[model samples]
Target chain A: MIRLRAKISSSRGQSTNISHKVGTWSFSAFVILLLTVIFFPGLFAPYDPLELDVINRLQAPSKAHLFGTDEGGRDIFSRVLYGTKDSVGASMVIVLMASGTGTILGAIAGWFGGRIDFYLMRMVDVFLSFPYLVLAMALAASLGRDMRSAILALILVWWPSYARMVRGQVLSIKERLFIRAARTVGASNFQILFWHIIPHTYRTVGVRASMDVGYVLISLTGLSFLGLGAQNPSPEWGLMISNARSYVLASWWYSVFPGIAILLVVSLFIYAADRFSGAER
Target chain B: MAQLLQILDVNKTFKSGNSKVKACQEINLTIGEGEVVGLVGESGSGKSTLANLVLGLEKLDSGSIKFEGVELEKLLKDKSKSFRREVQAVFQHPLLSLDSRKTIAWSIAEPLVINKIGNSASRKARVLELLAAVALDEGTASKYPSQLSGGQLQRVNIARALALEPKLIICDEPVSALDVSVQAQIVNLFLDIQKRLGVAMLFISHDLAVVRHISDRIAVMYAGKIMEIGDTDDICESPIHPYTQALLSASTFTEESDEGREKLKLFRREEVPQKGCPFSTRCPHAIALCREEEIKIQSFASNQESSCLRAQEIFPNLAKK
Candidate 1:
């Protein structure tokens, strides 16, 4: 009876494992499709994203216009495709810049942990105390209303969490016996920090960085929706949604398609990051 | 033989809240060029602490350690590359001593690379030569530390330590973590390295038999104090200190009765005294005077020294012999 029960559980586990594999494969394919749209929007987009057609403005979805037309009569499908480069690409850059800054600062702070650590961590605490979006919005508003300012503000707000994480990782890695061995071999403080300590932090930092890309995407589009990021007629997903807010009841396709694009890309990135960190363990 | 390293009246105290543990107290020893001095003591007897002091890993609370006639503090303050090249260490945990992410070749070549001795191609050749010296195959160089066995990783550690052709290598319980069968092999490797490279060593271990097998001179420590130190055979054959005698007897298996073993036992239920001799509470022959007076290591002969108060009375024939 015990063996029969064990057999039932084992088969259940096997079925879940198969489902997980399928989920991971499909997620990867969707990410690849997203990347293709980002890099070469012209391949999938029939109409030019910036072409103006005042007479056909706010057209509902039909055979000619698959995703219909927007406030400026720009094809919604083409705009979402072209906007992938601006929205998703900006988030990627923010994550990269934030992680790069965080890793270096955290390593230095953890390695030389007297007054420098005290001050740097306190500064990080100050940055972390505020709600990220509110602080980012204020900074973006103050820096002037553009995509560059929004990206810069988000990069500033996003880095503290990474800095705190990498610092924690460095503190642990520095205590490992291998680090002491490195010191015995005449490795300088800088050499030990970059070569010995930082290399060990890559796994945790990479996992965190992958996950941050998704969160940064949400925050970036949120900023654009509020007019703090990419301005009018830029074909940005959030800007397109903001433009469609008045005509949503009359022409639902205008806002719904770009919203779907945002949902798909963000959820896919987050799901992929979850799987990536799970596989690491 | 010229002195390669000298530790003079060094002290280190670790404080936790209000209590303090004196890890090393007035430690005075020297390792001459190409000499192997085995330091045997029980756990918490400050053998590794002394190793750390000599390596300049920990801050010295008091006194001085001189290497090649230069103060250790001065060398470390200058961040002297030559001093680092001259002294190296092999820790007890072989696997933990190596960076797991790095290949064996990279770990071994780290010292040479840091010291800027050779370019990449020459460093690769030198790593192969070092692998050969430690009896590891050339293919082992590409493998990660986790892939290697405890014994093989230890050999890699020894190779890395020997990379700069250091004048002294501190082996702190290097083989204690290995299997008993593998222990002998690693000990033999240390002996082989010492013989071929002529590198001085401060070999620290709790196992007296292992220490006696490879050391030229042996120092027996009890509770952070050197109970006895002499030529390996002198201390082994005639152990004047009660603690040294107990250590020697404990390492060697005998068919003695329970009562006999009880007489040979070193530990007593008495509290360790705050001052004077550290072993007085544990000493089987401890008297009232043993607990009252401050004990110092006194020379009994040209090469032998003991801290025990009753060294002369316990072993009267030691001086005559």
Candidate 2:
């Protein structure tokens, strides 16, 4: 056992660990990219997202405008960059809300079992019955169309998925010896849920949240596509796409660039989530 | 030392639909301070159920368990947490006993933190001290349970159990999953802890060799009832009950060669029957009464008894063979 420990410790120190390096790089890059879009949107965009130039209207890519202009002469490139603050921002809120609600609810259901689990899961099933986009649209429509409403709608629609995931994880974790050990140590039910069961759920649910962000972004964009999301003149990527759709044939750069912006963010999230799972292993 | 733990006619039954299972039947025993008691049994013998009962993890259908004269059930009411701090357990598997994602320090310090033992720095210091006490070094504090060796993890488990300075530790097959060499290290670690700390224990295992090595007294169980209870050496040297003799004969190391192993089969036979004596169907001396009699515990000596009808007549003959 002593010799085996020595071997493991020494091997862990070697530089040839390719997977360890790749995971670190991928995670750091995701953080840097997200922060640039979130906190320094102006610094990254070359042109003002809302700046209008009459002569540049429906123009194809030129030397001045890298992503060309939309029907209203606004720089598509700038709008897409600025648009991230809302699209990604709302998606982040939705992911947080869903994962938080789901994990807590699921943990309770799985941990306690019996009647609590039965009724709570039935509620989850009711929420899950609605199609993701339709439910978000219905919620956004009922609440009235705006960024905050859209985010609220998305949160309401998405939390059940997290709850289901969390509850399954909680059920399995609750049976573990550590949980029983915690009980044996006189840790209160609150402590066992927060300290023991919740930590285990975090490992499982953290990976799911990152992936869920990509899905939530797609769903939020779908709401915007149906005219139930961000309205005119807003810099959100989804609303920008809606406004630029008419000029697609004449100048594909407008809607295409914002479309690609959504794609890039979603793909980055998925990639980061995958890398996170690998790093944990 | 006074009796640290006492169980009086404890019973447990599970009802599922129309059927019922008597998981534990009239279990009674006493454990003195710092004493190690072994409850040896096959699967489904209610040893684990008894452990759960003492821990207040399961409610008994009848009877009561007292720790220093306080009823276990009453102690479990609102202050189950305090009751737990006094009585700890080391489960069968190390992998299953520690949360996989948490660091060894967090796992050990959690109970202390929840019980509000000390400040963060003090808790960390205490955790490190616990790690050191379990023979692990300072580096292990940050390592996750999955990264630790089985024996190291078991030692960490022991450390966690000792963190609250529990008066009694119930070890349910603590070393069963480990390799033979690793098992001995864990067993020795347990023995050392018991000796230095003087904490009472109810050690549950199916391995008689391990039971013999650690237990001050042994309780052999079959079909949810204790067949024999006595001093460890007495149980090993002179097992009175036919089932006890059958259990002893069936274990390895008793017969030398394959021929002797074949010859030993006469003493070691099949499973105990479902009803009556439980061992009646397989007993060579079985008569109509042996099959019809509802076996009850009979006294052989003080603090020693065998629940076997034919114990007196068969004791001398079995010892000779």
Candidate 3:
């Protein structure tokens, strides 16, 4: 999603410009929704997310329990509210780590083409050869099923895609006449790469990165569902789903509600990416 | 001063899967200090490639390019800042050359900033001076490259090239991307700058009239080689080479006159023919001998050379019109 903003702005149009554009509809939609969950989770979540009421467990949707009670007797709606941070935070961490590393490595490989490009691209290919889910699961399982481990595993599995994206962008941007002009004007290779070449590749990288957020969100959910992500008792949508799958037939609200929340957040970002990419100057 | 720059016995080739493109071959030319040498050629004649070679952006396959008797490659190998600061380029596209997001002030001030020439205040002062010289209003400094028109952006590009006070500016079709009406203003501005600053330039364009007006000397390139190079009047008024004659005549094809109408006659030329002689495929008067082998440059008038073999036989007595 951030990649979408990066794509439109060539250089120095980073976070500030994104907010100016996102501030229009996104502040109201994405920011408001996420902030409500982050800051005022209690306002949206009426009942206690952690307090167990096993006697009221498996309760159907009612006025008191809007999303119904789960097998653990925890309020599904309240748990989702609390879980929002982990679900979104994991995606943010992976996206930031992956895209940031990917863009830098890609830019370096593209600008300093030759052996650097060959080795870096080969490494990317090798990483890509491993099935993303399998590799992420292995790392998460090996490291321990924690949020930090999940994020680390996902970042390791994801950065190659961004690196490839940024490398493609940099390759095209470096060939442009402006880069040569920069060199002719006595710009050092570093200056030319950072100031001239890398900035121009932002749009393509931005577009690709923006779309990947949804994919990343889905993958993080998958990781948590497999018990390699936000573990039980955490409100993370994936972990919540994992906790409620046993009672899904009797109380569809357990799995269905968290799924809907994931859908809503993912849709918000996808829509935001589309809207921000449209705001290209 | 001694020759500002010299290219001797240069050659370049690009290999792609089974075939090769001879982009430049045995190209030799010289630019004296304060001289504007216009390099004219159609697209695919390696004009831009030549510009890139001159700018030290590409390596020469063979031969040598020298600046004031020093090897150009060596100067670059030594990372000589003065060599770089002394030479700059203005590309064809206006907006592409200038960073779109950066303010006009920063774009013009970039060279000074990159070379670390002066403090911010002096750099700011120089930016304003460049803007004024390029005839851009001070208010334009605040705007971005996207906010300006094609001509205004090109002016900004020219101003940036001037920021370092370069001794040579290689303008590769700088005005070609602009509208015809805007071209005159920019060309005249270049002439004005050259006269004032006495900066040598290699102004490249396919437009004969545009090049003829600004260039003290004109070098006509065909396929990777210079077919003709001489004083502008010598090439324009008495154009000895067939290619030069064809180009000058073709450039004026829009003039509503019988002469203009007559000069529009072009030989049916293939896009790329498997031939040694660069112009043989398109030369209207090409004979069996002209197609048999490669032709070397044949000297003519003072400061003039033509690679056209039949220059003596075909135009021995062809006087200046």
lDDT of each structure? Answer: 0.89, 0.82, 0.84
Q: How many backbone clashes does candidate 3 have?
A: 7
Candidate 3 lDDT tens digits, B88-179: 89999998888776788988888898888899999999999999999999999999888899999999999999998989999999999999
Candidates ranked, most accurate by TM-score first: 1, 2, 3
Instruction: List DockQ, one per candidate, in order.
Output: 0.79, 0.63, 0.59
Candidate 3 clashing pairs? A1-A210, A3-A206, A4-A206, A7-A202, A7-A203, A83-A235, A83-A236
Ranking by DockQ: 1, 2, 3
**Candidate 2 CAPRI assessment class:** medium
What would the TM-scores of all predictions be? 0.93, 0.89, 0.84
lDDT score for residue A50 of model 2: 80
What would the per-residue lDDT of candidate 2 be over residues B81-122, giving only the tens digit for each residue?
677778889998997888887888988997898788989999
Q: Identify the candidate with maximal lDDT.
A: 1
Worst 10 residues of 3 chain A by lDDT: A19-28
Candidate 1 positional error at B302, Å: 5.2
Judge candidate 1 at residue A262 and give its lDDT.
86
